[model samples]
Target: MNPFTYARAENAHDAFALGSQPGAKYLGGGTNLVDLMRETIERPVTLVDVTGLSCEIEERAGGGLLVGAAVRNTALASHLAVRTRYPMLARAVSSGASAQIRNMATVAGNTLQRTRCAYFYDDEGSRCNKRNPGQGCDAVDGFNRYHAILGASPGCVATHPSDMCVALAALDAVVHLQNARGERTLPFIDLHRLPEDRPEIETLLEPGELITAIELPPLAFGARSTYRKVRDRSSYAFALVSVAVALELDGDTVKDVRMALGGVAHKPWRAWKAEEALRGKPATAESFRAAAEAELAHAQPLRGNAFKVELAKRTLTAVLAELKEVKV
Candidate 1:
């Protein structure tokens, strides 16, 4: 690891000031950033600790929730309102990493976590465009069983690794950000960028900007939501394919739905096409299967990860079928 100066900021003002310095990075829980630093993938001259900032989970005035960026993953997953009102988010958080890591991982850190592509992490042996722009991406033609099938470009085939993000995407969560200039909000789905030619750039965040909170809009069907993850292992494993969905049915007819996919794209893929196809359609296995096909119609699978297309389709159909049977 590189020699670095560390400073703890107790408030947002202090965080912003310190974070604006040259080669400075805001530290939330240091779950992902610290590892990247150790691997020499991220080298910052200074670390501005922001874990002391807002950690509250406040209910919005009308409805919804405002989750502080510093809120720990365990806390967020266990919050009464989250577990009861937004079960998908809770389940997704619980499905990530392990209990120890979850205890230390913050909401913002998880939101900003980088991809876990093996090629991207092998700093010395592999050529990763995401690690160094225009250098080339080994994962594209390498062992790509876990690579992206959607929104992947010639420069990079990496998949975003956050399960929490999939649920956030489905919930239509908004990210609250602040920098030296001012504050702004971005839709959660728009936060991450697909790896195009410039695979190095990940999120759309402005330089030195800090994530303050994530706001989840009110969805009456949120309580009916669930998250399902399929991985090579039972625990401490990233999803090979994951689905987060919120379903609302009116007597076997789809009234409303929201769905997002993980481990198959550069970012959490909001299944807008599938949702569009399902509305007003009968809540049957055939309709669910057709919706899944519509969503994956444009998916361009890689050599090793082509099975993901069928896996995604089957998982989407099964999840919807399971939700359809639930008494709502």
Candidate 2:
């Protein structure tokens, strides 16, 4: 790790001021940042510790929930309200990393995690566009079995590696941010940018901008939601393809649907086209297949990840079928 100055931020104002400095980074749980530092992938000159700030979960007006950015992943997953209402979110968080890491990883840290692409992590290599812009992406031609199949550009083919983010996207969450300029809110869908021309610029956050909390809007079918992940291993493995489905059904017809996919794009892939096709439609296998196919029709798969297209469809179908069977 590089020699760096450390400062503890007293509040959001202090944290943003320190973070806006050149070569400074805000530290929450230090889960992902610490690993990148050791690998020499990230070498900040200063670290502004923000974990001490009041990071508590609060109930918002109108039956929503405001989750502090510094809340631990384990605590957020096991919270009584979260487990009882947004079970898909709880399941998604629990499905990721080991128990110890979850206990130490913060909610905001998980939202801002780097991709698990091997090329991006190879600091010694000179072919990762995400790590070195305009250097060219080695994963495009190299072993890219886990690379993205949707919303990818020639500059980068990597995918975001957060299971929690997929659920948040489906729940229509809003991200609250604070910076030296002031405060602002962004929809969770807009938080992550596509790896289009600038793969290095991952999130919409400007320099020194700190995520204060995330607000999940009142949901109708959260209890009927489900998350299904497909990976090489059953435990402690990154997703090959994952689906989060939060559906509200009216008898046999779909009343409303929120869906998002992981491991298939540069950000949490919201299946808005799929949702449009399913809303007011019968909740049957044929309807599910058509909706899934509609969203996947835009996928541009590389040589190694063509199988993801079919896998994603089946995962969507399975999740919707199970969610439909649950008594509302």
Candidate 3:
């Protein structure tokens, strides 16, 4: 919203070149970045529009999908291949922002979105180290119900807010980035960074890195996956405790499952421990309840977020039970 120079990039090379500038930033869909600019949370003197760099969905050799970073959420979700093979991801994309937003929000842009920390948006020099290094964090002890419970430190308590991230983690998607180092593929789980000592750096992307595409492996269970989100309202709200699960059950026994959580951690909290507990186990309510308990054993709830422990467990149990009833 401020005075920022804008240029439409022609290709990946051009995009990265512009983004590598000292005070320049890449513009994908302008969904999150524009909003942050409006609040002065992000103040870039130059904006390089990368949406013109033709990036779309393509089929990979492994029967998987290669989603270009500039591809809009609506296009990705509505694609026949994505709808048939990755319904959970489709549903997650649909659940985001709104129809108008989804039409403009790109896949990679949404994945790289910053936290919804209110303190970060305060332009009046509030106590937020993420906004200003060494400024201190005030949300650590104030209105932190939506803050993180995992991968949190005294320095910061912000939570990652992306439903598609949970689904991507559950499905083991890989992000392909083009930067000064050429091209590299990183695991989706490894993309986000914890607010350990530096809350300002939220991701592993270096300066000038352009997210090219996200590649999902040929997962047998993606079609049967489901994402369960619990918020204060039924629609248009962030999750209180959400679960994205892809389950394959054999009658009363579990075959395989992939689980991830949102609204609880610095990144998509992949529940590998919970998956281990449920695999090959009896697909019963008791077994699911036990798995839920086992998964939440290490959660360190804060002053106002103890309810998340119960909410997460119940949600996991419900998802497992529901999967069992309609086993793939």
Candidate 4:
């Protein structure tokens, strides 16, 4: 790791001031950033610790929830409001990493975590566009079984690796951000940028912007939501394909729905097409399968990851079916 100066921010004002320095990065749980620093993928001269900022989970006025960016993953997942009102978010958080890592990982850190493409990490042996822009992406033609199938370009085929983000996308969560300029809010789905020619740039965040909190809008049927992940292993494994869905049904007809897909895209892919197709339609296996097809219609899979198309379809169908049977 490179030699760096460390400073702990007592509040957001301190964080913004300290983080505005050259080559400075905001430190949350240091779960992903620290590892990237060790790999020399990220070399910051200053580390501004923001874990002491806002860690509260407050209920929104109407029915939503306001989650502090510094809130730990375990705390967010286990919170009564999250588990009961937004079960998918809880399940997604629980499905990530392990208990120890979850205990240390923060909400903002998890949301901003980088992709886990093997080629992107093998700095010495592989050429990754994400690691060094225009150097070339080895994962495109190399071991791409776990790479992206959606919103990927010729320069990159990496998938975002945050399970929590998948649920956040489905829930239409908004991210609260602050920087030297001022404060702003961005829709969670719009936070991450699609990897185009400039694969190095990930999120749409302005330079030195710190995530303040995450705001989840109200969903009356949020209690019926669920998250499902399929991976190579049962634990401590990233999703091969994951689904997060919140559905509302009127008898056998779909009244409303929100869904997002992970492990198949550059970012959490909000299944707008699938949701559009499912809404006002009969809630059945056929409808669910058709909706999945509609969502994956534009998916362009790589050589080794083509199976993801079918896997995603099947998984979406299964999750929708499972949620349909829920009494709530």
Q: Which candidate is the best by lDDT?
A: 4
Measured by TM-score, how close is model 2 to the native structure?
A: 0.99
Find the 10 residues in a row with the least total lDDT in model 1.
319-328
lDDT of each: 0.94, 0.93, 0.86, 0.95
Candidate 1 lDDT tens digits, 141-251: 899999899999999999999999999999999999988778899999999999888888999998889999999898898888999999999999888899999999988
Judge candidate 1 against the unseen true structure and give its global Cα lDDT, from 0 to 1.
Answer: 0.94
Question: Please, what are the lDDT tens digits per residue for candidate 4 over residues 1-328?
Answer: 8999999999888899999889999899999999999999999999999999899999898899999989999999999999999999999999999999999999999999999999888989999989988899888889999999999999999999999999999999999999777889999999999988888999999888899999999899999999999999999999999999999999999999999999998999999999999999999999999999999999999999999999999999999999999987
- lDDT by residue (tens digit), candidate 2, 212-236: 8999898967889988889999999
Cα error, candidate 4, residue 261 (Å): 0.3
TM-score of each: 0.99, 0.99, 0.96, 0.99
Stronger candidate by lDDT (1 vs 2): 1
Error of 2 at 34 (Å): 0.7
Candidate 2 residue-wise lDDT at 72: 95
For residue 197, model 1's alpha carbon misses the true position, in angstroms, by: 0.9
Error of 4 at 284 (Å): 0.8
lDDT of 3 by residue, 1-328 (tens): 6798998898888888888988898898998999999997888999999897656788998789899889998998899988888887888888777789889988988998888877777769569988888889988877788887777888888888888888999999999998897889999999998889999998998887888899989988677888888888877777788898888876768899999989998888999889999999998898888888888888887887889999999999998778666634
Candidate 1 vs candidate 4: the lDDT winner is 4
